[model samples]
Target: MELSEMQALARRVRSKYAAMETARYGREWTDEEIMLGFLGDVGDLAKLVQGKAGVRPRDDLDEALAHELADCLWCVFTLADSYGVDLEAAFTSTMAELDGILAAEDTTT
Candidate 1:
């Protein structure tokens, strides 16, 4: 699926989580809480990457890596939605800037 489709699914999932959290904790997670959760997922992804590198030694490493990556991506989409950021546009602009910088450096060298 495309980025927009993925983002739509993320928002739908977030809505479900919001309802669940409100029922359990009387409120859904705040933006900071979302960031913290993303951080935890990032940490998990790092360990899984190490396992992929054969330094951490995990069975079923491929599946774990895919899951963790998806978890991290979900957090990104959720955070972008919460913050009112156009993630696709931002990503494109950032990549374009990087490419320009690299091309400039190549000419200078």
Candidate 2:
């Protein structure tokens, strides 16, 4: 799906999770909780990738990896939205910074 579609889906997922948290915890989660949730998703993604890359499992891992990655992205999108950040611009800027860092290292070598 396109980035816009992904953003929309993230909002929906975040809302649903927020509702669940409120119901289970008896209050809305703090920003820290949301951040932790995002990190948790990232950890899950890492595990899925490692397994798919044969670090842990021998079974077909493609579906699990894809799902985990999508979940990770959803959490990232939610965090960005919560803070009123523009993900597209942030992604582009971060990638450019990484590229520049790599280029500078190449020149230094």
Candidate 3:
């Protein structure tokens, strides 16, 4: 699926979480709370990546790594949506800038 399609799915999942949070906590989570949750997920993702690389032992390491990566992506997409950032455009621009910098360095060397 395209990035936009994935983003739409993330929004739908966020809506589901909102309903669940409202029912459980009396209100949906704040943006800060969401970011904190994302931070936790990123930490988990890092561990899973380590496990995948055999730097740490883990059961079903490959599966765990894939899931954690997806979890991180969901957090990123949701956060971007909340902040009204065009993540795709930002990513493209950042990559282009990096490429240009690397190319210039190659010429100078």
Q: In model 2, where do residues sit more than 4 Å from their true spots?
A: 58-60, 104-109
lDDT per residue as tens, model 2, 62-92: 8777877877777778778889999999999
- Judging by lDDT against the true structure, name the best candidate: 1
- With candidate 2 superimposed using the best TM-score fit, by how many Å does residue 49's alpha carbon deviate from the native? 2.6
* Quality of model 1 by C-alpha lDDT: 0.95
lDDT of each: 0.95, 0.82, 0.92
Q: After superposition, how far is residue 46 of candidate 3 from its true place, in Å?
A: 1.6
lDDT of 3 by residue, 31-99 (tens): 999999989998988887777677887878888878888988999999999999999999999999999
User: Which window of 10 residues has the lowest lDDT sum in candidate 2?
Assistant: 52-61
Tens-digit lDDT track for model 1 on 1-108? Answer: 999999999999999999999999999999999999999999999999899888897888999999999999999999999989999999999999999989988965
Q: Candidates 1 and 3: which is better by TM-score?
A: 1
What lDDT would candidate 2 get against the real structure? 0.82
